[model samples]
Target: MDNYTPPFNQSLPQTAEGVPNKNSLSSYLPIRTKGNDFDFDAVIGLVLRGLLRKKVEGYSYEQFVADCQSAFEEKLGEEEFWQVLKEMYFENKDIFTVSPELLLFRAQKGEFAAGDSRVASMFTNLLQNMRVEEFEAKLNFVEREMLSTLREKMKPDSSLQASEKPYLPYLSKAFREDLKFLASRPKYLLSEIESFLSFYGFTYTVQLSLALVDWRSGQEPVAKPLYFIMDHERASNERTHIKNHGYKLFNESATRLFPMLTMLEILQPSSSEKGAIKVPLWEISKGIQESKLTHLKERLEKFARAFKSQRNLDTVLDESDAALDWLGNVMKLALAQFSIGERFNINKRYVLEVEKYLASHFIQNRGRSGRVLVLNQDYIILLTNLVVGEKDKLRFYELITAFEQRGIFVDKQTEQELIKFYERIGNVERMSDSGDAVYVRKTI
Candidate 1:
């Protein structure tokens, strides 16, 4: 595989060709774990650190305990300080220890869920210049300022520094725009703000996964622009037409891992193409799934030759009508290093796990289809707040358009449901009986 060169429209890693090149498929739609649940706070911490582009330093529990002791031991007795600390951090006070480091520090392991890396990478790439004021406002003064002081004081002493920082670029214009919209708002320290970020992260990740496409027809491969339809959580099963069609499309696209990788390989230019492409989100939706079957077949042949052994190469090259067979063949060849046997289900190995990854966050099983894309009330409210931004409110239709630009779609029935939901929550203002006159206000 290392020695093989791709055909004109196909690709492998373009390491020697240029800067800002994607090393693997993970660069485009990063899913590094086989199957693991996300830890939201850990993901937030990692993303915050990446956004700063600073040297990472750990703050030990021992140092944290000592700092607390020095600051509060005089004001409150030593025993009282320990009691307060235990009450604040742990539900079980019996686990408290005198040295204090063992409680939190001993359980430290640097492991994070697979999606966490993808989320953090995508976030940092999408948001390169986060406003300091907004960050501080969101986290509040104590979390921002005291953590800074404590980190500076307790930072590990090490001469070694990162040799080089990685160059991760934004892969989707839609995501970049939406993230910028969210960041532009005044950061509120409301309790619901944490839920907003958590759901936003999950929604964006699922949208990216569902909208991804690999275009192999042209001389160069291209990532087809992203868009997806979503059903309101309360949407009726019989009334939904566009939402059902959108779900069918989403289900088909969601399990495609190889095409995603192919798109990444194609998009990774020798030189950065950041300035080369800038199209309105509406213009991009027209180009989705434009790749020809013949082109995909040709790319598959090249992939089989590059990765398969002599015995398996002929087997993979055999003609097939099923897209699943083709994908399974490619997965088997590309992942041949893992020595996957012929009897094992390839879809379970490479495809189904992705669907499983999106389980409760972006997908639900309430509909007849078992798994369908859904936007619940909380996410809609958060999205509304961000889209409305500093404005008092936006025209209801315009707000819907903004949601579409961020790859979220709703049908007429769903839109009516959304308006009612907002109205019930007292965030919607109606000028008249028509949907066009309704305005959506920011919840924050």
Candidate 2:
């Protein structure tokens, strides 16, 4: 087991054969040190392109500079022109492009390229499921609230291009339905919708990537549950227990990622487990227990045969006790190859690095608890807007349930804090003292 070879299946999934298998461990997780610059605006750009079926037009940084020069060369001197250009375009905080250095309307080219297109493309492809006519109708509503005339002028021509490859995206039905419902709402701003898409885009990508970590031939597809402990950004000393419980639950969920991936990699390949991977999001909120591996006897026999064939082992261990010993050795081998430790850094790269990058927005760090799941104010507002789509307000209790459906959980203490926060911001209407009678409105 100590001298075991790494089991990396280089083959593409059967559903997507003959196409290039660009999916390595890094491609799946996408948490490289240099690739940590994930911009939400850029994510929106990619998703918009994907939804519109537009090609990556070669709009280079040089071309953009030249365009700026042509547009304002006569209006101002070289120094003044550059200063104005920087202030108007580059320094403008509202501009949403794949790279801030480049314009938003087109795909970037040359040395200043699109940052993290692979991950961005995941969102783009997910949005490709939408219809063109419906998207165009929604775009009309978004166009009504343009922040700048330059953003309007820089918009690409109506001509669009379609993707050559088919997309096979798998998301929980509840999330998928909610996303569509949010998109259909005409009151929401384009930036707000983009924020909603970007956050969920990253969340689903993380879950989907981890779920497919053990992908093999004839294996059942599953969505690994991502439990988020919705933290109250403002809480008093007495509410510390609420946060502690959240931290514990969050750690439990995050730490299980690698072990679950490893377990599926080893166990599922040897058996015929059929059914969609139904993740119990709310059920585990009470407390999570370690998953016990079952059907060891049958799995051990199959694993022994496969191991003997692959490693060419000649040992004849047919008895139950001897088989158990071999099974232990096999488990150790698989753990060494897949788990994050001195031996292998798979967990470090895929799990830890991802959480590190997502901090400040999707995650929160507190007193020795490390990275506990959280949604910052900006995200909370975006989510609230989406959850309250097409409606003036939603019942406070129903709103919490909606959050759960999207993989976010909040306890009673946190719930009270949330209502207070919302009330302070003028988004909640309290009909009675009870939390159930309260109604929350969309800030959009």
Instruction: Name the candidate that leads on TM-score.
Output: 1
TM-score of 2: 0.58
Query: Lowest-scoring 10 consecutive residues by lDDT in candidate 2?
Result: 281-290
Cα TM-score per model: 0.62, 0.58
**Clashes per candidate (backbone, < 3 Å):** 1, 0
User: Where does candidate 1 have its weakest 10-residue lDDT segment?
Assistant: 159-168
Each model's lDDT: 0.47, 0.47
How many pairs in model 1 have backbone atoms within 3 A of each other, for residues 3 or more apart or on separate chains, i.e. clashes?
1
